[model samples]
Target: MGSRQLESFVTERCRSGTLTVTEACHLFDRLLTTRDPAPTIYPFNHLFTTLVRMNNLTNHYPTIFSLFNQLTQTNQISPNVYTYNILINCCMRVDRIGLAFVLLGRALKEGPGSNPGVFNPLLKGLCKDSRIHEAAAIVLDKMPKLGCTPDLFSYNTLMNGICKMGQIGKAEELVDYMVSKGLQPDVVTYTTLIDGLCKKGLLDKATQILQCMISKDLEPNVVTYNALMNVLCKKGEIEKAEELLDFMVSKRVQPDIVTYSILIDGLCKKGLLDKATQILQCMISKDLEPNVVTYNALMNVLCKKGEIEKAEELLDFMVSKGVQPDIVTYSILIDGLCKKGLLDNANQMVQCMISEGLEPDVVTYNALMDVLCKKGEIENAEKLLSFMVSKAVQPDIVSYTILIDGLCKKGLLDKANQMVQYMISKGLEPNVVTFNVLMDMLSKKGEIEKAEELLDFMVSKGVQPDLVTYNILIDGLCKKGLLDTAYQMVQCMISKGLEPDVVTFNALMDMLCKKGEIEKAEELLDFMVSKAVQPDIVSYTILIDGLCKKGLLHKAEQILQCMISKGLEPDVVTFNALMDMLCKKGEIEKAEELLDFMVSKGVQPDIVTYNVLIDGLRKKGLLHKAEQILQCMISKGLEPNVVTYNALGCTAQTKRN
Candidate 1:
């Protein structure tokens, strides 16, 4: 057959959806032998397009590349932009992104009436590799400059990439740009944004986006509802999720298996197991079978509540329903067993998993190792590591981290350092978390210089210091009374775009309080509030304790009232600190009233409270009253420690005086 006849055969077969891989290749091979009237690029485009869409057992990508190369070199036909797009797509799917971009560069140079479709694959490839900025640049600059105006596909692909990488602001900008270009936001666009916003915990904004989509007369698909529902469920807003489900049903959107699963999972998380079971039954009544994901969620909640036998029964139920347990299912069971300290049973579960031909993954191994480390069985943990290596399961960063943390807690710093080195040698670079652990331990041990060195080393290694890293250094400096240096570290973190969180402010406030710089600590508090960092209960307690120690009873009481105004109920420690100061001031009557107030407010006083009251009575020359208080404490079932008797010793001394 002639080249055009061969081309027509391939094109017809492709268009009719009857083209087999073998048949396409045979025709392409036949075309390469054409001597006259060579075929155009249309035939090659058709075949490559079909091959990529098929994506079967064979490596059709390499075949596409090979056929393109041979036909171009041997035939008199010229390759067009269509051929380049296909080749670029093929390169992308195989992760040869560099080659895809190279093809793009060649296409831009050839300049055959630039096609936006040409850059879609390139954008997709970049996004898949997490090269988001480059993808955005191509959409905003390269495509337009090359006369390939950004299309809906181009915008959607880049937006999805941005959202995945936690760049929600940029994704929103892309949506605005999409609308400005007159490409109305489609269902996919709305769904992607909602998913991103939901993931970022911007649930209210995500709901607004949904409302906007509805106003625009765009019907949300199951994917859109699922994304929003999943986040709401995750936030433990089961009631909100149910309301959303009702709204979804009102709009004629059917609740698929995923929707039911999400509802079940959400209810389970809120400890409403009966509600979850009802949802599961509702799902089954609709002829929808529950999968392992649905069962896993219920079992996980049961395990968390320490109802392992109930979880086991659920697992059996899952299996009877023909839903074979996967790795996640077994991992949950193993974690449940480990948490209950059933080490032997946990090991047996692992064996059972293996017996069912499911190999335990890194997560499963990490879970086992973490339990072992916490139990102080370092040798057993190390043995598990060796077994993992024997099974060809290379340990990830978490495995080494767990061992390091265990060693550090046991004061085996040298062993922990050795493990860090070994992990690095195994080609796994420690992330921010690993460094944070090491720095925290070193700082606590007064190894401030070494901790500072680690910060510098991590920076040099191209790992930017996060808030936790800076907070550690600041706290370390504060503990050493290096206030100026700690302030400098806080400022440095700010310059690095790390805002001072409540923890950072608290550390500074604590150091200031310790130095009797109450005024300065209060200023820091104001600064934290101005910066929108609300002080936690610890922050208030520190200031209150500092004022109480300074004998500023009125000022301390004001701080206590302020805390209460902010809805922070004073804990036992806060009350004890205040009562101790009152007793020392010889205001035993007022201290007694404060003790009654704490008890009436449901803040139970401990032995410390009684000791303070007894000591106050002794100082007030009321030995009989102090003895009656001690008897009351004993009657209340509090075991008096040396402090209680020491107060009586001081009472005898007072009598002698």
Candidate 2:
């Protein structure tokens, strides 16, 4: 075949993703010895460049470079800057920066004869490799010397590199230089600086630069506004960001995909998911397509807010729109499903990703394992762990923590400990959540000292104790009757700037009540209400039960009424305690009244409620009322147990006397 025919064949094969680099080179070699020698060098250079672009030169760099050198030696064609730049880019892509620089030195030494096109690719390679300083030096030294004036693109690339390096001062200096050279900073230029400042968390500085850009009569483009909005939203200045967005719309700077993404992410972070959905709808109305980042941000927020159904809907919408779901999208849905205890759905999503030819990432495995663990499907979680390892997907701390927590919650403390040991053996450090789970499990088993010891160990390991850590330890100590110790822990949590949540307050109150310190429990309850921490059902129940046990029926009744006034309904246990207290106090009428009130309020009385009333009536020598209640209980499909029989027999004996 002619040399052109060979080149066409190689190009076709490379584009097909089926040709090996070696085979392409071999075909090139055969074509070079053909009768047609004129087109040989260009075809070979084209093949080598194609290989570099295709990212198929991993183990064949030396071969490609040697072929280029051979083309130069035979003088079939001279090697230009494009060929060398392509090789440099290949080196950078493979993280071989040193080799890239060697190519750079070769290009620079090639002097005025070399094509200045080399500088563009070189700068791109250096910037991508985070060698921004080197790239900046090249831009300063090479472009002018080659008589190649730096374009707007070159300046933007340099500025972007400097900004990403967190050298905003240097980036500004370059921007000023670009303007002084009569090259005005365009939207790309300002956007880069704004993005850099935002990334470094200098929102005010970013805003100032944006204002400066606007003052320069250079309108803030979509990118400029999007960057500022993203930073502001991230910094929790969503309102101000929205205001700027309003300005953007008024100025006719149409919001792009990124603009919508920034606002969506911001709203989601602020728990304004409904607003986020609105922005997403607006984006679609504007004909802007929601990208993967946009969908992932929306999915993440929805999942976190326990809006799993909406999140799933979004996932389907994204798929129907032909926006491929990345690992992040899958992971978000998996975590949301797991959190909602939908393990089957979560697993199906994972399998779906795999079936779509996307390998499950570590995050996918971790999320699935977490759901399985929470569902008490420990065996399935373990199976997933093994599958993760088998598939070479390394398990992270989240994976192990999920398993440990599941085992601990299932009362498999020994297995949990073994897992902890396994994590340590594998050189993976346990995070705060891991230790919290273990300590909570130990505390529930009444191993208060062990829980405390683990707490100390966690702190010693430099894992800062968060609110959860404190709450678990305090709850454990309180449950073990170590009220003083638990209270001390509460103080420590406050000292650390962590406020006690309602759970902490309730635990403390319950501890005090169990110790017969009803007055202190009441004080705690009052303090909790004062703190604006609305007492949950457990809080009211504990205090009410404590007062009732102390024969303080009036106080118990007052608390019950207070709970109702506060929009908290009493549970079955609460009603039973109240009835028992009233009956024991010889107020059978009041006890029956409370039962009627409970039923009237649509609170179904459990068997315990009826038994308490029946026993109380019989004890008060109301034999007819007691017998009527027994028959009423049987009619209600509540079988009379031994307590019921005993109470009835006692009433019958008293009646016979």
Candidate 3:
């Protein structure tokens, strides 16, 4: 059979999808034995090109190369432009740009019987595969010497490749070259350059190029405006992007679905929900139906701003508009519900996704698991985790972190630790938040040493500790009566360039007070105030109680006076402590004065306050005064507790004597 018959046979087989490598090789071998003087090049080239296309599709580059060699060397069949195009496409697909260049050189120099047609495929292939420089070299230098001129497709392809490579300078030069050679760049050429500049975040340059294209009488297409709009929106230039949209419509360039979607997403991200809603209305007004992407963008914004009711309303509107919510839509609602601590509602939405035939992606499950874990529903989280594993949804670092944090919060430290180990075994690294959670739990359990070891482990793992981590450790040490160690930790935190915040100062103050180091605690309190760190109620309360416990009643009174002077009004606990101390020292007059001052300040005395006052009067043998205060307390709707009754009974016993 002739080459035409052989090619026809291969084309038919390829289209039928029944062609095998062994069968093709056999057919090509038989065709090689033909002794026809005028061999038909068309059929042989077509057969070879078809085989090359098949090999490229299957990513069998080597097979395509071997076949190319067989056709040229074994069969003595001349290669054509079509043959070179196929081979270069394969090379480009495999990212073998250098090998593609070598083949282009061979095609340029060693044409079919040393002709120019062989180089046509090489140049066309380079252009199609976006090898701009090689195409330019052949078109500008080598092809002209061979008396071959590149067509408009080749020029446009070369321009696109150059622009895409961000060598816009060279691309502009190529455009100039094309115009000099009596060629005008079409919309594709301009769009390519415009898209290229936009991708590089050079919006101004892209706009300049668009103006240049317009000056050249090339009207901007929907794609041109879309690219510009997307770039402008991403840069937070929404007003300019909107102006462009108006300009596009005025210029008779219709906006596509993507154009509206981009603007909606941009406005939603900027928290311009009203503006986003306006754009959605405009999109519908223009008879351009909003897509799922548009609805999802609005939904995500509403969900993030805690507008779940509005988000759900929009979702219903989306469904009514015949736009189905995709994975992103479900994920947004799930995440929102989870954040609001409504796990059951979140799970129902997830089930809705599944009922709609949408398999929950890792993000959907992770959000659900996070909510369950955060709500201390570890059993449900573990069950979901098992379901995820069974469904082949591999657990990422976040999944492990959520579970670990939950376990630690529930005081299941050993299980939490095991999870950390499991995460490492799975080749996932625990992040800073993970360590902080574990450290906080350990500290709360009085395992200050273990918590410190974890902190050290975090450092060893190259995870830098944040302020919360340091505060947890300091508070733990202080609670365990290790004031010096807690103080040293504060120094360490400062050395690490982390300024001690209110929590750090409070921890230190608490430690000193617990250790009876009232003087140091007062000094630290002074420093805290000077640093503009307002002492919280706990800080003032701790210092006051500490001084009173040490029998330094004058100093304790001074601190209380100073606290009030600083506009820090004492709470009920503060008054109770002072009263308890005064009554214990038998200072009835001073104690009564404090009680009167407390009442004058509108600080109603609680049961403890009344009990303290009654006990003080009874101890001083002022039974009449003590009984009168008890009656005043009862009349004021303050019930006498067991302590009050005991104090009153003591006064009654004294009265009977």
List residue ranges in candidate 3 displaced over 4 A: 1-260, 341-344, 446-452, 465-657
Between candidates 1 and 3, the one scoring higher on lDDT is 1
Q: Report the alpha-carbon TM-score of model 3 versus the true structure.
A: 0.52
Selected candidate, larger TM-score, 2 vs 3 = 2
RMSD of 2: 5.9
The top-ranked prediction according to TM-score is: 2
Q: What is the C-alpha lDDT of each candidate?
A: 0.88, 0.84, 0.83
Candidate 3 C-alpha lDDT tens digits along 181-265: 8878888888888888898898888888898999989998999999999999999999999999999999998998899999999
lDDT-sorted candidate list, best first: 1, 2, 3
Candidate 1 — number of clashing residue pairs? 0
Q: Model 2, 419-527: lDDT tens per residue?
A: 9999989999999999999988998898988988888898899999898889988888888788888889999999999989899998999889888899999889889
Candidate 1 residue runs with Cα over 4 Å from true position: 1-21, 30-46, 53-60, 70-84, 105-113, 309-324, 355-357, 370-376, 389-657
Per-prediction backbone clash count: 0, 0, 0
